[model samples]
Target: MEIIHHHNLAMKTEEEKLPPLIQAIAAREIAGFDNANNLHLHDLKISILDANEEQKQVSISMPSSPIEVHVGSSTLYPMSDSAAKFHSQPIPNNNKLKYQRFDSFKTWSGKLERQISNLRGKPCEIHENDDIENLPLDRFFDALEGPELDTLRASEEIILPENEKWPFLLRFPISTFGICLGVSSQAIMWKALATSDSTKFLHVTPEINLALWLVAAALVAAVSAVYSLKVIFYFEAVRREYFHPVRVNFFFAPLVAVVFLAIGAPPPVAGKLHSAAWYALMAPILCLEVKIYGQWMSGGQRRLSKVANPSNHLAVVGNFAGAVLGAAMGLKEGPVFFFAVGLAHYVVLFVTLYQRLPTNETLPKELHPVFFLFVAAPSTAAVAWTEIRDSFDHGSRIAYFIALFLYFSLAVRVNFFRGFRFSLAWWAYTFPMTGAAVATMKYADAVPGAGTRLLAVTLCGVATVAVAALLVATVVHACVLKDLFPNDMAIAISGKRPKMTRKWRHRYRRRSSSSSSTTDSDYCQGN
Candidate 1:
């Protein structure tokens, strides 16, 4: 190859310049060369390219395109030696001439490093997953997409993505209580269909029995999946326990226990053992609920302002759930105690949440689960009242009527969820619908009239369909889209609790900080 040199620019005589031996040493000292053959061709090309812009234009279109060169508003191409010069006329700095290389090589090498590193993962795009709605799968599929399968196999530790600095895994919302609520709802339906003597459920043929068992199996599978998520939520995210308002969801544990107890064990399993297991679990959950409610009540009327949406009804639902299970277990006083506490607090919360408009921006309308609470509390109360009072009396009638009214109100406004993104909050629809159905069945059995029976059948069918839709949506979003949780890692990591202020301000600040601090949302978009 032809070489470029600054021989003509030399001010010294031939003898004044060092011999080849000394030059080799100088090259080694300046650029760390290992041999006389070693050359800084890239630096030479850049310096040469800088020497004369007019000359670079000629180089751009030539055969020397083997080596890439970048020029202003031009493509990268190789340059000839003729386009290079080791030393040129003085460079201008601060509008004055300064003859210097100015350590520009470091800057050039650093830029190259950045460009090269960026190229590695850009070319291979992950193929888009198939549309979930088209897939034929069961609800068990919902648990398939959490944390990578490879990561789980490789290590027991949860290796969160870089942006997941939050203390919890994905599914960390208080609305997750709805998962247990959903299981309980299904379990309640199963119990009603298999055991109720009403005309609506009289066709308990072999096929119906098999279908009910299938529903039971689905309930069991769903509970296990949701419980695994809970372990990730509570155990891995130990610090999040301090997120006080969300603590209300802990009631879901007891509610789950109630469902299991209500279902009882199969023929082979000892019923007493099953009862003991549920009792063991519910005992702590009940105590914890007491402590948590005490803390909130201690805060008094001022704390009432911090109450979340209708989802807060899980607090009352928990007590009602416990009451149902307790009454089944023959614990008379416990059921009545739980029923009284649940009913009183729920009424207070209902009035409070009803008067308070949804002013928080942190909860987008699409993701909001609070409205379902309207149906949930009264329906749960009615079910609990039947179990506690041993009949669907006037009190149960009142609770069922109230829930029916709320259910119709929300049903008329079902368009709200159309614009909403799929979230764990959607599970909110399941349990409440089931609660209403269970309440309706109890009402039907008591009244034994055509109108009551028809309403009971209608409610049962609607609840079944609603729960089925929610289960399918959950499977699609959780298993297919892998979008069970929003990217709230930043808020969780910030560990910033909201001060008792206007709900909107607190919510706005939370969302702003979350978006600014992380790219967690981008991961969801990619999936």
Candidate 2:
């Protein structure tokens, strides 16, 4: 590229020596020529007239077909006009430029002229004789004819592309079963509160318990239907979820919800349905337990210590829930067997989490609510032991006290549970609180007193308020915000990290700087 500086100006190699306006115009012209020709042939020349000249012009010349530019008071004109006549015409100074070019140099030269005019704060104009078919917009649409146009029309008919067009049922996650688990546990807590002698003065009624059970049952049915469809239509997705370390724990939730429903069944249905449901559900629970628990002990990729998190408590708690239901239905030996299996694993899992083992999985702050499961497991075990022995015995008392201690241990760390945005993980708070409330009620029965009764009522009230707040927040999040179904399939199918939103990205950065133990992959698995 050669630049000719006029008015006795010295030839300088540095582009910075040119005036700012000329420099910008020259740079844009060079870029346009390079893109259009896709070659490095340096045959372009730019002529810059002295600023003091009466008719200062910046003319760009190309080897193939040259075009000249005349700059006059922020307006551009074609080279065909004479210098004297160009100034004589009364042209509107709307800062618009008009030019004509040959077919060979039409694309790049026209773009260069428009950009130069714009650099001088002016618009580019097309002459009346210019073909409308050669306009940029018309050319773009012309290229999209035939198959491309038909594909565009078909896409416009649908809301999303073919790959992303998933039915609502396919979007439902197994973790959503946690909602049914929470509601069912709440129903059982209400039933226990109504039946206890020491809390009789609170005037809790059977009707309230029954109503809560019905709501829980409806939720279970809906969730079950959606998940069943997922299993049939997207069985691969189901398989992926089953293999996830954190997500696999929630697969036990639906069974636990069904067990709670059976335990909390009204007096009329409790007799016939309780025995039948216990027998039917027990087989599947034991089969899953054998597979999962065997893997935990046998030493492989699925070792317990490797995947241990507070969420794993879900699997342990299911066994206790089954034991409680089994004992309630007057099964003597089966409940004891399930209780022993659950208690053995509970001790190991609890200690692993407490020690914060180096190999154990770490959850992000958003999932810290599952830490409350520490309180749930022991509390459910306490209730199971009480039902098995037909009384809140000394052994049951010890378990209840452990649960009470853990509840206060977690409750005092207010910051650990606050500041997290609403998610399905918030459902983690509901069942654990309800479990503690039921344990406290049983404790109150063992030692009747005003203080004991007050403690039970307070825990029950807190559990009730937590569940109600979660329900409202979930409705607003899913309906108003439209963020409930993020379709975070990366973790399961692709082994890629879920994309973080702006708020979560900020939080992740802040937490990352403060702590180095957790990594980006851990955050993906936790969510």
Q: How many residue pairs clash in each candidate?
A: 2, 0
Model 2 clash pairs? none
- TM-score for model 1? 0.61
The alpha-carbon deviation from the true structure for residue 210 of candidate 2, after best TM-score superposition, in angstroms, is: 0.9
| 1-527 per-residue lDDT for model 2 (tens digits) | 13344422432223224434432232232335434464333343333443333343433333343324333334322222122121112345453332121211233434465679889998867543222223232221222212111112111222122344244544578889988988998889899878888789999988888999999999999989988887765564565467655567888999999999988877767867646668799888888889888978997556776667677888899889999999998898899999999999999999988988434334556677878989989999999999999999998998899999999988987766776677788899999999999999998998999999999999999999999999888889889996776644322222222356786668656654554444444445444
| Minimal lDDT window, size 10, model 2 | 147-156
Off by over 4 Å in 1: 1-44, 48-177, 200-202, 205-236, 241-244, 247-261, 264-278, 300-302, 357-363, 495-527
Candidate 1 per-residue C-alpha lDDT over 405-431 given as tens digits, one digit per residue, 9 for 90 to 100: 998887876445455577676777777
Q: What is the C-alpha RMSD of each candidate to the true structure, in Å?
A: 15.8, 18.1
TM-score of each: 0.61, 0.64
